[model samples]
Target: MTRFQSKVALVTGGRSGIGRAIAKRLREEGARVITAQRGQDTEFECIGVDFNEPEAADDAIATVMQLAGRLDVLVNNAGMMQEQLAEEMSLVDWTRNLTVNLTTPFALIKASLPHLRQTQGRIVNIGSTEGLGSNPKHAAYCASKAGLHGLTRAIAIDHSHEGIRCNAVAPGWIDTDLNIDFIESMPDPKAFKQGLGKIHPVGRTGTPEEVANLVAWLASEESGFVTGQVWTVDGGRMAKLSLPG
Candidate 1:
């Protein structure tokens, strides 16, 4: 699907995990992809910037414009999670969560808007199902992601008239390296894994590629009519009611 042929995309944190998958998918669909990540990226041109210093997003956009000349797609994929209850979580940690997940994307979108206006480009934000529901020790994460979804809609409504569409993908339980590591750290990894799969209607957890596929569609002209929405790719987990054990 050469939907993105001749297009250029910038994916934040594209060096690994879900971001890596999104970049790979865009490249496969014929988009010239650049990544902004903390470490050097050998697979594609990378703009090294830590989201903690969100001012870097502006520089990243500048670097992309200088090198790629035009940006057609902006995938705000880099995010962080600090597992602490709201009571125990310090103000600093909570602020960091908002900074990395919500504020940085806002900065990236703001930086890319002018270029996206030129190309009538698209923005795909990586949100989480937790934005729609609660999770233990995820007070900050849920709030940040919910804010991101709101930002996504606000951008779509304000800028779609300018030919740039904005949308968000709220994914659940994707088996990225970080998740795998978490699962492995469990005392009974196999048992925990089995229970994790059972929570989803698909009888298994999701993969980064699956999330990337939806992102690809949203980022392309194929979904020209779809914007200001949060699409959940959760294998039906949210739709099902859990029975108490």
Candidate 2:
């Protein structure tokens, strides 16, 4: 049998990028996948949820429970990032980043905890390398992701005895629509990509599939003992530092 055979997974922001890749991967591994996004789509059992809204987490959880009766895995993959230095960022931008990145995930996990505990399920939080270290023009993004790391650990510590495992996957410089759009908006798109690519020891950006694979494993029985850990899949980006000239 497949690793995730007979499992039910609810993935947030599953319409695109890493979330979409994770949803597809879960389905391929024999899980009945349900997706929640701001827009509807026929590709899967999609539930519309404006994650920016306060009630969206509860609404999405209700939809998932109505469809599957139980949630065996919750992938909190929905998040937003703003590019602004600490000095330039406004309260609105900072609040929005935290709301989307940190608050929403916490709400989703809380809403799903009962069902997850019943099934001995897992929570896989999609974090970022920025959570672990500094980045230019990303104060809000970094802070929010770092907060997620703390939240993930808290969940693991509080619920591990109940058979619910919580872990985080921090990806680095993934090549996704978000990144592509940012690059395309630049004056020299090719140069932007190349310059960004060079920072990674692997000489390339990580793929959504690679991140998805790690998440899948963490959510499955293969990682049954793992909890409260932050796994980094960054192409060695966080391991190297630039030397002084």
TM-score of each: 0.98, 0.94
The whole-model C-alpha lDDT of candidate 1 against the native structure comes to 0.95
Give the alpha carbon lDDT tens digit for every residue of 85-115 in model 2: 8889899889999999999999999999989
Model 1 CA deviation exceeding 4 Å by range: none
Given candidate 1, what's the lDDT at residue 121?
Answer: 97
Residue 244 Cα positional deviation in candidate 2, in Å, after optimal superposition = 4.4
Per-structure clash totals for the candidates:
0, 0
Could you tell me how far off, in angstroms, the CA of residue 8 lies in candidate 2 after the best superposition? Answer: 0.8
Model 1 agreement with the true structure over 2-55: per-residue lDDT tens digits: 999999999998999999999999999999999998889999989988888847
lDDT of each: 0.95, 0.92
What C-alpha root-mean-square deviation, in Å, does candidate 2 show against the real structure?
1.6
